[model samples]
Target: MKRFFPIVFTLLYMLAMLKPVLPVFDYVINQDYIAEYLCINKDKPEMHCDGKCYLMQMLEEQNNEKKQNLPAIDLKEYPIGFVTLINLPSETTTTTPQKNHNNYHNQYRFLTSEQHFHPPIFS
Candidate 1:
């Protein structure tokens, strides 16, 4: 099911990208219907606009909608805030040496713990 979701999403994304072409295909296939009912220059047949005006209007409307959906920002008018950096001194620690023991079992005691078994986050 997880793999199927990506395939379906990719197909859908491709289909959405081809949305503009669908209008041209519709204009080619249904030219007669568009000219008869949807054309703006239906009265002026001398210009030879066989539903081309309707197609242009549809394309222009789509373009306008795309333009409207974009976020408007004016960076020139607004002043940006200044960034400041600070440095801090880190503390040093000294370790004391421990006495060595001859117990081999103590070394393997924490080997099975979850913290050591898990991978390091920094890596």
Candidate 2:
């Protein structure tokens, strides 16, 4: 009984030390956190794009100018097909639906399924 008591106590102590090493599988990085990390303004997220958008706009303008300079090609005169204009969605619109606070929490809850099968290891 004395030996068993020491064994049990050692086991409990090891478990206590290992408890903190367990990974929090439900932990998730949020968009707000990303924004904060990137030092982006919450009110004007467009500012996150910085001058990239402006540069793209300038390139598009140049492309348009080149297209205008080219001689007009009539589709009826040639058998080959030609693309006139490509319509793309505005950058201001988000393709993916925004996740609300509840949705974000729900996503994190679902992410814990992996933890049930394969628990994460913390270093």
**Top model by TM-score, which number?**
1
Which pairs clash in the backbone of model 1? Answer: none
C-alpha positional error of residue 78 in candidate 1 after TM-score superposition, expressed in Å:
6.6
What lDDT tens digits, residue by residue, belong to model 1 across residues 26-120?
99999999999999998998999999999998899889988999989888766566545557788888888988976667554444555546666
- For all predictions, the C-alpha RMSD in Å is 17.7, 35.0
Computed on alpha carbons, the lDDT of every model, listed in order, comes to: 0.87, 0.56
After TM-score superposition, the amount by which residue 96's alpha carbon in candidate 2 deviates from its true location, in angstroms, is 77
Cα lDDT tens digits, model 2, 1-123, are 879999999999998776543322111233344435533344577567533344454456656876998999887898655656789987895588776766344444434454446677899
Query: Where in model 2 is the C-alpha error above 4 Å?
Result: 1-47, 75-123
lDDT of model 1 at position 33: 97
Candidates in order, TM-scores: namely: 0.58, 0.25
